[model samples]
Target: MRQYQAVEETGMSINKKIRHIENTIVLSPSFKQAIAMIRECHERSKLTTEPKCMLLIGNTGYGKTTIANHYVGQYARVVSKDGTTVPVFYSMIPSNATIKGLACRLLEDLGDPLYDRGTTINMTSRLCRLIKECKVELIILDEFQHLIDRDSDRVLRSTADWLKDVLNRTKVPIVLMGMPNANSILTVNPQLMRRFANICELKAFNWNPVKERDDFLRFLIMIEKATFFPQPSILHSNEIALRIFCATKGVVSYIKKLISKAAEIAYVKNLDRVTTEALALAYNDELALSNTMSNPFLVDHENLNIPSLEQSFHNSSDAARHGGKRRVAEILRR
Candidate 1:
């Protein structure tokens, strides 16, 4: 008789290198527009009198960073229609930054340091001069939401005004990346809003069957295949994928972690394919606050202490139907 590896006991290995990039979704038209504009700014750096500025707004894990990275990569190599060359410099705005600190970061990115000794105003003047001299065109400020923590609204308003002033003085494009809430912040400040005349919002993945599913799944499978190097594994069926979608609610970061954990379980059991059993086991094993793996009353597989995991398929199926919402509520209330 052949022996079956207990689903509860499986251990799967995962490729960490691949997991890092799994969170990035394919670029949509909105994302492409941001890329196009950023490139235009870089390509027109030497010629344009007025600088271009864009503000990118999005929820977490919505590929804001990835899109920004992609923009930098493309713009760094921009070539003119007549085969002329342009240099694109990239700089990150430091978290919890003041105007002087931001100027320092920009100076550092340009391979120099502001040596002028005086108040913040003096430093700002020196930095502006350097930016003009260097002909820097594009400035990307990531995590710009931190500026809101200023104790005085005046400070915040001044920061916004100063940034607007810098852009006008330098004639350089600026891209601000931050959480969704940052959009409201920018809208409230007239100066900031004017600078961000062209706004782009990045949203989470939408599994609309018409256009996204193909690229989305390919992106997913690519991560899975690359993460589990040497020994490739396939999902037992689409059902497993659906379960994953339901469990993670399409959060790319959580999806990778759940799948990686499942693969680790499968690897431990020496299984070549990831089974529903392994997936369930992995789901149950996840200790994060967001996990919807197994219902509280549903019981775990025979060996696990989760009573709900031990419940019969009929009850488990019912739990799956109600989505274990009641059970989860009960657990939370406790």
Candidate 2:
């Protein structure tokens, strides 16, 4: 009975730490900049007849969604004399996003019960009308890269044209958030290219000694403060911080995971604080890094295993960017 109680307590304690990290987003410098830029776009959107569009591009787990949520929180939906006034309208591009699916998604966000019931044109008219009726100042669409996944040129062009028509009809400033390759959707259609003049990006932290390192450490410190388990987190310490950077490649989500995993290990074992051993074990479990030598927490790092800023930002397909296919070929041959 006592053993079962101890196990339950351990699970509960670790779960609290994980939940704390998951629920709270500790804003990084890039995250703050993205927010500022979005605010600027919102302000600029209000004053002009020709609405300015912003393309917010980032890799997975870079906190682009968090920025969008933050903006939406600031200008909440309100009941007014006329009707509901939604300063910001936010939705995601639907999976297998066709023209009709896109319209239905927008209609659904605008509170239409039978969103899926309308034809493409019917839903488009409804969306435009709601934007005007609700006095919506900005429209934010996330996961826009869904339009590109496994699509042919003809379908891509059709979807792009549909988006252009929406922009023309609504005349509301829009923020399109997607993965880095999402720019391809714009490049395919020059009309969209012209609409989206302002571009913002959220990126992982780099291993620069002067500015970036301090920024990363500060961000980690903030996250550590938020975790409910204990204090004096060793994650912000110099050596551990560098190892974390190497492990996560400075990606915000990966960093949070590593810290949370380490916290779990510490909590379950009744340790007071996170340790390198806990971190090492977490590193092995969380990441798919097959190279044992590259395990930052376990191995003594001679140098940071981070890619250059230029290399990280290079535009390429995922398959092209990763060379793991060669290893697969070798394994098959054996």
Candidate 3:
């Protein structure tokens, strides 16, 4: 009975920590800039006769979708012809996205019927009419990387051209979200590429020695508070924190998982605080998991040290010129 109680307590404590860490999520500086740029473009697009499009390119787990979600919630708005306002429609391109599937998804978001006979053209026309009717300021398409994943490249190209025509007709800002290869897909379609003038690229987490230490401490504080079972205590080990930065390579997604996994292991072992021994076991487990699955995004560093800001921000000079707009152009040009 006592053993069971201990296990129960540990489980409860671990769950709390996980929840706390999730709730106290932090956006890196680059991500914050991207969100701000998107918000600004959405606002400007609503005021202008021409649509202002933005293409968000980033790596997986780098908060590309999260930033888009935030902008959709905060900035995206539908303006009525008579000046009434409401939230704009948001949709994501599916894993097995086809021209038909993407059209259906957009129509569904606009509360239109998803019946048969709506070819990519029909659906695009319908969507443009809806956008005009609803005065949708922005059409945010997440997972736009799926554009290249259509059954055939021809279908994908057709979808791209159709999307460009819709935008040309509706004059509504379009935000495309995807990972690295998304640029290649967009560039292949000249019309689509023209609409996507503003490119916001996001890199994985860059550990700012100046800011990371504080961020690391704050993260540990949240972890401590979250670990309720076995009595919460602070992590006094700097070495553990260093290992964390190394394991995650400062990428927020991987970092979140590693920390959460460490807490989980500590809970299972009935440890109050995450000890180095427990951490080592967690590392081995994570490494094993990574071998079986492509999970972690750590970089090659001596003893797993985080990369310097210089390495992370190699494109800083280029990014500063257009304040990020040119960054997308750079990618498209490449």
Candidate 4:
């Protein structure tokens, strides 16, 4: 096969091959828009007295963190006479994060070695000083929903107030990213909600509207270009596209995982290209899909049941609640 010949000629190692496949990042339409929005907000924050904050909400594995990381990379740390200046700072909210814990995490990200030793007040004071010292213009908090406890109203209000206090003191734009439930933290605090007036939602792809389907196919082509197979795989074909959509429920992350696994399996088996059998095997092996469900790739397009496919999607979402591995297993069981 062409791919096999190319691999042999180059003598590429398996580790390098896997890294090449894993490192591909497609700049989809939504991702591009998010980058633009972040830049605009960052620029506006520099000139305005009031911070222009944004809430970025989406399902898990919907590229929310990836977009934030991309934006941060654009303004990586700059060396100057004074010290290192980080234009964009990023941190993750610890699960059930408290005001003190949040403060310590921010301090740690700011390069403070003694962050964990400080009390809440001491940490907040140091955090404010470091923010100015480091010249940080924007802060991104991923998994921001963890700031509030669902069971305690007192904890929720205190944490929300702490965030507002930080914004008032720093006047730096903050982007909070997390699952859709992250909105609840804002809904409970009107002042905080009003401050973060600019809200962005990252949605998964759907087969509706011819354009969406066409765009997904284009995305597949992009993925195929990055993926190294023994031979060319017609991933953009209508049959494969429909089957992939059914299997992944239009989630880009899931699609990437499925393709990567299938590619790896094809490479190991010395196959010319990924076939329906390889895809089915990948689905079972990587996703732990239950044998009870029909394999999308193996079934006829016309015979595919919409309700059953949707149930698979629902199961995937439900499984996400528990964790990644469990979620996959749960979906297959359904």
* Index of the highest-TM-score prediction: 4
- Please give, for residues 1-334, the per-residue lDDT of candidate 2 as tens digits: 4433543553555566578777777777788888888888889878988888999999998888888998899898998777888889999998668899788888888877788886787888888998898888889999988778564523366877888888898888889999988888888888899999789988788755448877888888887876544447657776777778778878888888888888778767766667788888888888746434467776544333534532533343543655544422322232
Ranking by lDDT: 4, 2, 3, 1
| Lowest-sum lDDT 10-residue window in model 2 | 325-334
- Over the full model, what C-alpha lDDT does candidate 4 score relative to the true structure? 0.78
Q: What's the residue-level lDDT of 289 in candidate 3?
A: 54
Q: For candidate 4, what is the TM-score? A: 0.87
Task: Quote the positional error of residue 281 for candidate 2 in Å.
Answer: 1.7
Q: Looking at candidate 2, what is the lDDT of residue 304? A: 35
Using lDDT as the measure, the top candidate is: 4
lDDT of each: 0.59, 0.77, 0.64, 0.78
- Which has the higher TM-score value, candidate number 2 or candidate number 4? 4
Clashing residue pairs in candidate 4 (N, C-alpha, C atoms within 3 angstroms):
290-332, 319-327
Better candidate number, 2 or 4, judged by lDDT: 4
> In terms of lDDT, which candidate is stronger, 2 or 3?
2
Ranking by TM-score: 4, 2, 3, 1
Error of 4 at 129 (Å): 1.2
By the TM-score metric, which is better: model 2 or model 3? Answer: 2
Better lDDT candidate (3, 4)? 4
Candidate 4 weakest lDDT stretch, 10 residues: 325-334
Better of 1 and 2 by TM-score: 2
Please give the distance, in angstroms, between residue 86's alpha carbon in candidate 1 and its true position after superposition: 9.9
Off by over 4 Å in 2: 1-14, 79-83, 149-155, 228-231, 289-293, 303-334
